[model samples]
Target chain A: MTGLLDAAFVLLILTTLVLLGSSRIRLGIRVLAVQGVVVGAAALLLPNHHVTLRVVVIVLIGTILDAVVFPILLLRALRTARVERETDPPVGYTASILIGVGLLTACLWGMKYGGITLPHEGANPLELPVAAYTVLAGLFLIVARNNALNQILGYLMLENGIFLAGLSTAMEVPLLIEMGILLDVFIMVMVMGVALFHISRTFDSIEVGGMTALTDWPDQEDVGK
Target chain B: MIAGLILIPLVAAGAAFAIRSHPVRRAMLVSVAAVHAALTARLWVDWPARPAPVLDGWLAVDAPGLLFLSTCSALFLAAAVYAVGYHAREDVGEPRRDIEEGGLFFRNEPEAVFAGCMLLFLGSMTGVSLSQHLGLLWVGVEATTLATAPLIYYHRHHRSLEATWKYLLICSVGLALAMIGNFALAASIPRAEAESGRINLVLGDLLANARALNPAWAQIAFVFFLVGYGTKMGLAPLHTWLPDAHSEAPSLVSALMSGALLNCAFLGVLRGHQVCTAAGFPGFSSELLIWFGLLSMAVAAVFILGQTDFKRMLAYSSVEHMGILALAVGCGAAYGMGLHALGHSLIKGSLFLTSGILLAAYQTKNVTKIHNLLADYPVTGLLWLAGFLAITGAPPFSLFLSEFTVGKTLLDADRPVAAAAYLVLLGVIFLGMASAVLPMVHGTGPVDHEPAGGQSAPPGYRPPLTMLVPPIVLAGAVLGLGLYLPVDVREVLRDAAAALSGGVSP
Candidate 1:
């Protein structure tokens, strides 16, 4: 079981990299769905945690939010916007992939050399670094993608990463907060979908870069200076 | 009573949604505001006789919480008055853009939704002020964002829509980071203590066990909490959404957002500082706070100088005052900081409300296109300049007294360099503010009185008395408190200050 957990953790991270590198929007969503399932399974595998009914329920809720509800929301937004691919990302695909790898490497290297350890003596080293990488990767997605749909995907990715880390590290995290966080994430994504539809309607596309009408430097002489 | 404070606004919000009549909904909004303000005042007066209870460690009202609660209610009540007046004028449908070529038409917003969300925002902010548990506090903070996002999109124009998107996405992201910070905080507790079932985010419990927390994780948690809440507070580099949100939202909403909402976020930061102080890491938090504070001030000064829109200018001014509030908190002069927060709120709230009047008169946000408020709308023009002066920390305003307290604290702490820098920043900000205000208030087109939507205002047109009174009342509060600090208000400040400094109010 421990071996499987280790493999699942690495696979979860591998899927995140795929999320970072993949240009097909559908493929990214599928990769994220797999990552979500793996994270849920891994939540059950955290060492020393009593697998109570509450934990099981939380895992179920989180899984549904991550793997099921989110992807549907993203797909609806994407279809409404009629965009199927993530193209002309702010950072190039190769560069974003490199950045993801760099973030993972930094987290691993910091864990080893930076004297970082959880307050709990037996806390597993694998979860924190992987979770950190996932977060950074999500941030990269949001920053690099100009499409509104893609940005929403990135935000969901970010929340998922936080959930994985929070659940694994903080045993005292009450069931109430876990449920609240899940609900907040779901509503946030739903709102983003509404906004994406509006964006598509208003700008004729869901491209975030098209939002140049409202800006600080409006005059031509110093528009961006 | 505490429950009533939270529930009243919420029930009003529900009723607001259910109501179909616009006047009825508007009346409900103001009535709720009045009741809230009254409750807060009663609570403030009765604090000593009947202290707030901590209910199962989930919710408690302490001195600082009451201070914040009162300020939120007071500022909100003033803004509520202005909102009713604002909608009255807005119903006249001023020209959406410049009064040329018949102008652009903005999409109509649902009045019920707007009214409902405003009340919901009030309830959520009240929740933030009273919440003692970290998770519940997080809920309130996030709810404030959710409630206020629609308020920002009230105009339903391209700009308001964009601002709404930014406000929602960015604040949600910031709050997600805060949740992770909370997780880190829980993780930092000693394993034995945590396992002993004393491992929650109840403010008192966390402070009690602060000594045993892992230093490394505690520092990590503090950083995330600061960055996360700081984003909401509109601190430098994290304030990207502020100007857009404030400028695009109705001026009344901007008033509440600046005067009332920012303080709630600042309370979250103060809670972060409280934990740091408890953990014997005051230096760490203080240094970061001061730096973020100065950086915010500097960034705001630059933007205010370049800013052309009057509402956006007020937004940047909000950023500057948030910085000063941060600086005061960092300086550990709890009394001074709380006072400064109050003063800034009174002055800033009035200023934003005044901005709404200016917008109504000129029908444009551009400072270049507006001139001679003294020549045109006399009351609003005079109030505009007065608010500008008051906000810039000029003498004869309450802001001067509070700002001075912070500067004295910095000097007493032997940070003369910081004190001097703070002063210099204030000067630069004043200059920047003056350049924008002088022309708007004193310069001479017989400034644009052609009300947008092709509504005509006669030459001697003045803003309605209801629209005029709220800001005048706020300005009086600012100037009055400057002249005389009542013993009652002073006592409240002292108790709240002590509470923030890790000493339970005596």
Candidate 2:
């Protein structure tokens, strides 16, 4: 079980690296789907987790929504929006992969030397560090990428990271509350998809870099400094 | 009963979508708002006499919750009333030109979506106020973001679209971080508690056992909670989406966002603070809050100094007041913070509604282009001026009392340096806002300034009574509170303040 969990974590980390370096939206969604499944399965592999009907249902629902549902939604959105790939992200792919490596290294280093421990004494040590790395990677994806679909993918990755952390750390989260969290995530992704569709429709592009009409800075000519 | 308070609006939101008639939906909106307010008032009036039981420890109305809940209820009522007037003006067949993209035209989104989202926003905020479980509270906060995204996109234009996207994505990401914070909070439980296999997020349970919580995990939880909810609360460096969202949304929606939604987000932070305080860890959270607070104030002041759009200026002012709320709590003036939250909500809600009227009459949001307000529209002009005065901490308003209380509390706490900085920031914000507002309210427009909207309202047009009354009523309430916080209200505020700093978390 421990080996399985470690393998899942490795897969999660590697997929994040692939996501960071990839510009192809389809490939990104596929990688995210794989990552999501690994995270959902990793929930079951957490040490001391009681395998019950409710937990199984939640994990099943979570895995299906994250792996199959979200990807299909994004692919549909991608098709409708008529965008093929992420174009001209603020950060380059090679640099992004390097940054991902750096983020993973930092997390590993921090876990080793930073006196970090789970609330429960017997929980797996790899869970928190991997979770932290995935979260940072997700946030980096959102910030560094200019594409809306890519950002949504980043958001889902972030959600997956949080879900993993929640499963490991908050062992006693109520089944109903877990359902609520999953439902919220589902609605959030739907909302983002619709909003993305609207953005593409209105701006004729889904690039967030074009959103410059609203700002606080005084125009240069008006400031005349 | 608490469940009903949350469920009623949610059901009405569904009804709003199903209903065909626009007027019926609007009527239902107001009726729901009124009922929610009445029930909230009953919580104050009747429940104290015979205390109600918590619903399975999932939802409960404590002092701070009730206070914030009351504020939300009251503001929702005001915004609901104001929205009727707004839609009456806007929902016509007029193809309003998109101001951001010149020469492009747009129409309002479906009335069902707007009305449904409004009620849904109310429902979600109610959930936030009543939630006794941290996980439930996180759900409520995220639901609020989802509910209001459509409301922000009500105009169905590129700018509103962009604003909606930013609001949806940024807030959702922020809230995801908050979920991580929730996990960290759960992790703060002692191993003994964890071994019992009943590690729940019920506030009372956590508060009872806070002393045994792991300090390291508690610190981590507090950081994530602050950053996560702070982003939603419009603290500086994370407030990037606020101005755009507020300005793009309809004025009534902006009012609700500033006055109600932000307070609910702040309440999320306050809940985290309550837990940390119970766990004997106040210094860490307090220091971080004060820094974020000062940064928000400084950011607001700079933006307000150069703000061109009137609506965005009000949004920035909200960030400033949220900062004040944070600062007051950091300084241990929880009592004053309670009053400040109420006063700020009422005043800011009124100001945004008044800005709606201004937007209608002038067809422009630019401060310089809008002129002769006192001469052109005396009532709106007075309300506008009153909002400016009240919000800037002028005498004869509750904000004055609250701001003074907070400053005095800081001084009494032997934090003269912080007190001075607080005062200095307040002074700068006042000046900055006045420079923008006074001219807009009292100054003249350029000689060649012709109203720009393709279908501008006629000169000397007056807003209907429905629109004018809500702001006047809200502003009047703030004034009345400033003059004399009735015994019952003051008592409630005191209880709320105590709840913030109470030895046990409420």
Residue-level lDDT of model 1, residues B367-410, one tens digit each, is 87776677667788889989999999998998998898899999
Candidate 1 per-residue C-alpha lDDT over A23-94 given as tens digits, one digit per residue, 9 for 90 to 100 = 888888888888889988988887747798978888888888779987887777777778788678889889
For candidate 2, lDDT tens digit of each residue in B1-506?
A: 78789999999999999999988999999999999999999888863452454667778888888888888899999999988888887888678876555577898888898999999999999999988888888888888888888899999887788788888778887887787778888888876666574556877787778888888888888788888888899999899999999998999999999999999999889888888888898887888888888889999988888788899999999999999999999889999999999999999999999999988887778887777688778899999999999999999999999999999998999998889999999999899889888887777755556556422223666799999999999999999999999887887888888778884644
Q: How large is the C-alpha RMSD of every model relative to the true structure?
A: 2.8, 2.5
RMSD of 2: 2.5
Best by DockQ: 2
Candidate 2 local Cα displacement, residue B168, angstroms: 0.8
What Cα-based lDDT does every candidate model obtain?
Answer: 0.82, 0.86
| Model 2: pairs clashing at backbone N, Cα or C within 3 Å | none
Q: What is the fnat value (0 to 1) for candidate 1?
A: 0.52
The interface RMSD values of the models, given in order, are: 2.8, 3.3
Off by over 4 Å in 1: A221-225, B50-54, B92-103, B445-461, B503-506
Q: Write the per-residue lDDT of candidate 2 for residues A1-225, one digit (tens) a residue.
A: 889988989999999999999999999999999988998888888885778786787788789988888889889988988888986999999999999999999998998799988866578889889989999999999999999999988877887887788777876656433844565565656687778878888888889888876667646422110
